[model samples]
Target: MRETLAKWRPAIDEAIADLIPREIDVDYLESFFGEATYEYDPDGLQRALSDPIWELLDRGGKRWRAVLFLVFIDAFGEDPAAYLPYACIPEILHNGTIIVDDVEDEAAMRRGEPALHHLYGEDVALNAGNAMYFLPLKILTRDPANLPADRRLAAYEMLMDELNRTHLGQGMDICWHNERDVRVTPEQYLEMCACKTGCLGRIVARLAAIITDQPAEVEEAVARYAELTAVAFQIGDDILDVENSLGRAGEFGKEFGNDIREGKKTLLVIHAIEKSDPERARRLQEILQADTNTDEEVLEALSIIEDTGGLACARERALDLAAEARAEIDGLDFDPGTVDKLHEFTEFVIDRDA
Candidate 1:
């Protein structure tokens, strides 16, 4: 699996670069943005927009989403290379969200570098991110020979549906964090994860099915597998955030305790609050609600969450979810080799350290 990923990662990166381009001429930018300045700077808005977009893309992601799409293609005994453009769509969409999410989360760093908003300001980052959301449409509809109009339309609609669900999930997350009276349960958290994270995974699998002209039942099964993997992936991420803070700072290319800093309603935090005594619960709420918490305060919150068995509970849930995902993969009628690869991928999703 690692070898396959290594071989394909560069190809995926090149495809994205070709699709997006590293440099956009100033004339194109001016026309695109409707700028009519007397002193037209060749390297003005065009560089401003294209630079950050490329920078973020080049900063090195695992490209797991693209790999998942290709793996599905391979499982079906199809030429994965033929669907490279479509496979790139999910990664592009995911990175676009990362840019916007960092701005919304006020994240200071991403992939071991300053976030797009931090480097290029929120306005530019926001515009670039939003623009990226539509770029995939062009790819999907570019060549009728490559992707039939019907299938293209289907993929486009699926992409839109997934993005809509993602925004709705983001709304829920924002509202929960800001509203002091809102009480978030584990079920609510899972739903949010399904929307925000799982939806992308579903899109990838479903798109593969659509492009390959697979039966509806197979698409449904693959979607279920992807959704379970996504939820488990998110849980693992939350757990890593806390565990990383203890002694693994800089290991994951992200700041430790970032979720706590953002006041995110992680499963660990939710479980901890549910099980905490009155005094500890109050303190936890105070920490999460504060405008800014010190490192010590964040550490204390982690300790409290640990004492309440929140971390352990979240880990157990993640393992269960991963197991379920594996089961779904097994149930699929793909080649046995494909099933084995998928099972391996499921474990990777759940057990990835970074």
Candidate 2:
């Protein structure tokens, strides 16, 4: 699986580099900023937009979303190279969201470097982030993959729906964080995970199926598999936050206990609140609600979460979801080898440290 992914990663990167505009055209600048601004250094404007976009892309991520897309393409017996451009669209969208998320979360680092917003200021980061959000539409409509018009339209619609769902999930997270009195249930947390993390996986599966003319049932099954994987992936991430803070801080390119400081309502936190004694629960809430928490306070909260069995519950749930995801692949008509790879990838999703 690692060898296969290694071979595909460069192709995915090339596709992204080709699709994302390297230089902003003069006419686009004129239209965007009006003639007065166009009279200014267009090169400067172009650099302002293109620099941050490339910086973030080049910063390097695991490119898991694109890898999943190619894996699905292979599973469906298609030429994965032919669909490389399509595979890259989700990754670009994912990176764009990361930039925006960092700004919103006040994160200082990403991929082990200063967050784009921190380097270029929020204004430039916001502009580049929004550009990434809409830029893939250009690639889709242009039919770089030479998909049929109907298929292109279908992919476009699916991408739009996925973006909408992701935003809605982010909105819920933001709202929950702001409303100090609000308590999130496990079901609600899973729903949010489906929207925020699962949507991209679902989009890739459904779009690949659409492009390849798969039946609706196959598309639905593939999407379900991806969604389940996403749920497990998110739970794994929450668990990592605690683990990384305790032993592997800075290894994952994110701050240790940052989630705790931000008062994120992760699944473990939710479970801990529900399972803890009243006094412990109250203390947990107090720590989470604070605008800032000391490292010692964060450690205390982590200890409470562990003692109350929240960590164990979260780990079990993640493993269960991963198992469910693999089982869904069994119901599909993919080749046995492909199914094996998919199962392996699902395990990797939960087991990955970063």
Candidate 3:
């Protein structure tokens, strides 16, 4: 999986660069959004938009969502290279979500550095983040693929539906963490994952299907697989947060025990609260509810989660979802090599350390 990702990463990055370049200028603005009524301030545009945007993009990301988009195209029997530009849609949008999410989460770090808001101010970061949400739409309007009008419309509509669901999921997450009394069920957490993390993958699948002119059934099958893998990946991410905090593994980009600090009711927390003795569970809840926690409090929360089988259960859940995801593609008539890649992709989602 790493080898495959390495081989494709450069190409994926190139495709994204084409959509959003290292620099923004008057000509670029005119080309994308049309000429200004008055005059365009290229210098101001570069300072405010391009500089900060590229600052984050330069930090490494796996670009896996874009790769998934291309993989779907290949699986559907199209030349992925021919439709590479369209693949940028999900990658761009995913980054946008994280940038905005960092601001909303009051996150202190991203990709091993200060969050965008901290460096660029909330106003600039928010605008730049929101700009990414709309930037991908230019791909459709520009008609880079010269897609038929109906296909373009289908892509637009699919993006709208999926993006809306993402916010709904975010809303659920915000609400769950805000109230001390609200206990998020495993089922509800899964639903949130499906809506938030899974929707981006769904966009990859459904867009590939739409552009390839595949039937609805084919779209549905691939979309289900995509959603499952995405949710499994998210669950794995949540588990990693706990593991890293407990010093069971090397640190990743995120701050240790950040979820516990934020009082996020991750599946680990949910399972731990349910299985623990009342006192232990109450203590765990108290740690989660606290406005701030010291290293000792975070460690205590980690120990409770581990003792109550939260880590084990969450790991099992992630693995189970990955298997289900792989199963979805087992019967499909995709390219054999691509099917193998998709299987590897599912495993990578759960087994990845970062």
Candidate 4:
């Protein structure tokens, strides 16, 4: 993972820096927000978000999936600026999703600080997330001259579609928390990942292809391929959440380990329940259902996960998805170097420490 990132990092960094014009690029994002404001103070909103949301973005880990779109656009001879507005859309949307997710999960910490809702109260935090969510698409609709009317319309449509899929997936995830008694099959878990993570990632990939005006068939194929890659990414996240404590600390540069405590029906946890001895499974089920459980109880549940083999199965399945994505992308006309870079990006997702 380190090697793959070291190779791609410089390229992505340079590309992102040049995505917007030099003059405005050097100006602060808040300044732009200031310019576009409705003459009212967002004081409360600012206080709630100024730290957690921006810090979350700035304390960046690997931003591979977003970079994939920017670089893919570069591949087709378009300037990276051609897609600059949308470049950060995926990240913003992802962060907004996390904000809502933390409140829904009643999560306590975010990047070593209190989760937004925990710090600012749920209603305020949700409003903060809504504000953040609006910026990405608003930016996407910027520069009408850069994006043609048809392309602009297409971008909005895809953006809304991506958000809808993610919201639906999150609803399923939240519902699973309350319905822990139900069995979740491996196939079902994969579908869940597709809705949650895969959909947005694939949206960006397909959008990248769309900017090139690639044939409909080709764009669909690339999106389908990217969809699988996204699933692998989310599966890897489930593994990290159960197997590692990084999310709590913010030290590993990646959030970790809430899925189990929150009873997310990730493939890893589901498989463990499906595979455990009846007695052990019962113990885990108790932990899952324990809303009043202390951190110690959560730790005990972690112990159960350690003894079960479900986490390893999740890792294996993620790798399989990556392989499938690579095979599908190989069918496209992407340049050899681009294909290699993309493959590196895919493999790195599961292998990554963050």
Which one wins on TM-score? Answer: 3
lDDT of 1 by residue, 1-354 (tens): 787788899889877866666776655445444586665565764565668888987788889899989999988778998878888888998998999989987778899888888888899999989888887667766652386678878877887888899998888887897876429889999999999899989989998998888888888889989999999989998998888887753343337678777787799988988899978988887888888888778888888898999878998999999899888878877888788778887786546775
Instruction: Give the per-residue lDDT of model 4 (tens digit) for 1-354.
Output: 345445555554443333322223213344445454444344533555554455555556566666677767776667765555566667566777778878887778877777878766788778767766786666655553366777767767877887788778777777777785848778877777888888878777777876667777777777877788888888887777765752353343233345555666667567777878888788878877776555666666666666777767678888988998888778877798778877876786566875
What TM-score fits each model?
0.89, 0.90, 0.94, 0.78
Residue-wise C-alpha lDDT for candidate 3, range 1-354, written one tens digit per residue: 567677788888787777777787777888877889999998877777777777888898988887888888887878888888888888889889999999998888888889999999999999989999998878989887789999999989899999999999999998887889537889999999999889999998899999999998888888999999989988998888887777743442336798888888999999999999999999999999999887778888999999988888998999999999888898688778888889998887655775
- Between candidates 1 and 3, name the one with more favorable TM-score: 3
Task: Show where candidate 2 strays beyond 4 Å.
Answer: 21-42, 246-256
What clash count does candidate 4 reach?
A: 2
Over 1-354, each residue of candidate 2 has an lDDT whose tens digit, in order, gives 777778788888888866655676766555444577336676786667778988988877878788888888887888888888788777888888999999987888888899999899999998889877877667676676687788888888788888899988888888898988538899999999999888978987887788887888888888899999988989999998887786743343337687888888999999988998989999988999999887778888888888988878899999999999888889888888888888987886556865
In model 4, what lDDT does residue 81 have?
56
Q: After superposition, how far is residue 318 of candidate 4 from its true place, in Å?
A: 1.3
Model 2 — which ten-residue stretch has the worst lDDT? 247-256
User: CA lDDT of 231 in candidate 1?
Assistant: 95
lDDT score of model 4?
0.68
lDDT of each: 0.82, 0.83, 0.86, 0.68
Predicted candidate 1, C-alpha RMSD = 3.8
Q: What's the true lDDT of residue 224 in model 2?
A: 90
